[model samples]
Target: MRALVLLACLSVSCLAQRPQPCTSPALMTGDLYVSTQSEKLTAFAKYMYDALGKRIRLREVGSYNNKTFELDVLLLYRQGVVYKINHKNSTCCKKRLCTKFHPLEIPENASLLGQSVLGSSSGPGQGLLVNNWYGDLQMKKGTAKYLSQVTEFGCVPVSVLYHTDQSGWVVTSFYNNVIGLTDPQMLYPPPFCQDARLEDEDGEDPETFFSLF
Candidate 1:
């Protein structure tokens, strides 16, 4: 009886120690590595996020249309505008940003998969402990789902796998070297973008568009 009682106590203790869902910081800067399976494209970018101000910026270098390209994308949700600047031609295009701000956070309805160490845990402070969570994204169009791995302590996003019927199932993003937003100006559109021509809106759903990246 005593042995059984001890096992029950241990099980309860483990359950109590499980980490809960969490939200990320309001201001953050990081490197984003993205892979799109359908396009056969891989991109490396520096990202700036301001959840409080509903702004995001990405400076990306990748291959597009069989050519190497460098682009800067600025999303200003509050102003409902997006700026896409092509470095090779020094041209910018302005489009309507239909999506709302979506933070790097674990949804409250997400199911906790498990807890594990990202690296070797045999030594002290040698590995990061993370929580894996999976959930379906609530979208207005096609089906969407996501799996996220975040740090157990600060809930800092480590990686995410997002899928949608329109875009296919093989988009992955890795986030690293993250820190608090260093410069507020990084979120603003560059001076050259002021003369950007407005493009015709494609009538894409806001939720579907945001989930692509």
Candidate 2:
């Protein structure tokens, strides 16, 4: 009787656990802070989630030592903002538990600060508007422009919201070159938009996709 009970206990211990999705859309978000090792991108995906395993999921997209690439980072996110803190080989996200998060501190000014204000425009806009670049690629051409900016003393353009008043971010992508911003709010995230492995413009999914970025 003891042996039979022990065998059953072992079987239960080996069972796999399933991940669940958010039960509601209550504006979910994450904070991130990252570190890198010799070009090795580990904390690449800095989005946080519930300890219960439902907030974020990672799928290997592709790689790059040099060159522009794309990926499939399908995240059904519902939250405030994803702060890509720091730069270069690292990007730290901010969730409730992140240690580096700090509130903005700015002096209040009422006198003339040499600023121009204009009424908001209502119309369709152009350019990319995604946040949290995921997927995979070993770019021989571009670097983690955003992280690299803070890493190597360069500036990276990060999209605040997908041109909307709020929707948070759509995707984080990379472009071969930099884009200009008229409204800080309309700026594009460092690189341009990227497609996922399965969502590549060519629509080709590698037989075996592995991520080392």
Candidate 3:
């Protein structure tokens, strides 16, 4: 009976230390930087607190179709509610979207990228674990230059930079093929907010965008 009791206690302790699912944008707030190794993509966010509520302003830039693609996103979290305003500009189009949703909809792996940061300490619940599943990968001869564009392309190195308690800031990089797939809500906002958008000349041909993918 004593051994059984000890086992139960140990199980409870492990459960308590498990990294909890990220149900709050607050976990992702503050100053954060995310980027790809090739420097083709980069994002920065600054969260500030004031009398009204906590607001996170974000800016991201990348290259598409040999042109620059940029996004400005503003997230407001108040009273357990999340509100978002995002503007995107690229060679294909310019879009502005707004939406409101519950934080519970966000997956734990969405913003818990700190886990893959290189040289970061890990304990019972420091970072969440994610799996990358791939199947049916095909390649053609003389297509070596286009491998990076393949949806199931080779793995790439990604890094997440964050502020630490003792240290000023730290960076960690890891291999990822499906980086943001876990965050569907974040990748594409609600459809209602997608109306009245502006399309660039190249937007007419979506294939031009997918060809690179």
C-alpha positional error of residue 144 in candidate 2 after TM-score superposition, expressed in Å: 25
Kindly list the per-residue Cα lDDT of model 1 for residues 1-213, writing each as its tens digit.
Answer: 999999999999998898898997878887877665467556678888888898888877776435566767788989988887776676788998776677878989999999999889999999999999998977655557888888998888888877777555544455665667877887877777887877997743222123364
Residue 172, candidate 2: how far off, in angstroms? 17
Per-candidate Cα RMSD to the true structure, in Å, reads 4.2, 23.5, 14.1
| Model 2 quality (TM-score) | 0.18
Tens digit per residue, CA lDDT, model 3, 1-213: 999999999999998754443222222322434443344334343332121234333434544334565544434434322223443332222332232222211233332222232233376545443322212211121111111111111222233233322222333333322322233244233454445244333332111110111
Quote the positional error of residue 117 for candidate 1 in Å.
Answer: 0.4
Candidate 3 worst ten-residue window by lDDT = 143-152
Question: Looking at model 1, which ten-residue stretch has the lowest summed lDDT?
Answer: 204-213
Q: Once model 2 is optimally superposed onto the true structure by TM-score, how far is the C-alpha of residue 63 displaced, in angstroms?
A: 7.8
- Estimate the overall C-alpha local distance difference test score of candidate 3: 0.32
Question: Which structure among the candidates has the greatest TM-score?
Answer: 1
Give the winner by TM-score: 1 or 2. 1
| Candidate 3: regions farther than 4 A off | 24-56, 69-98, 102-117, 120-213
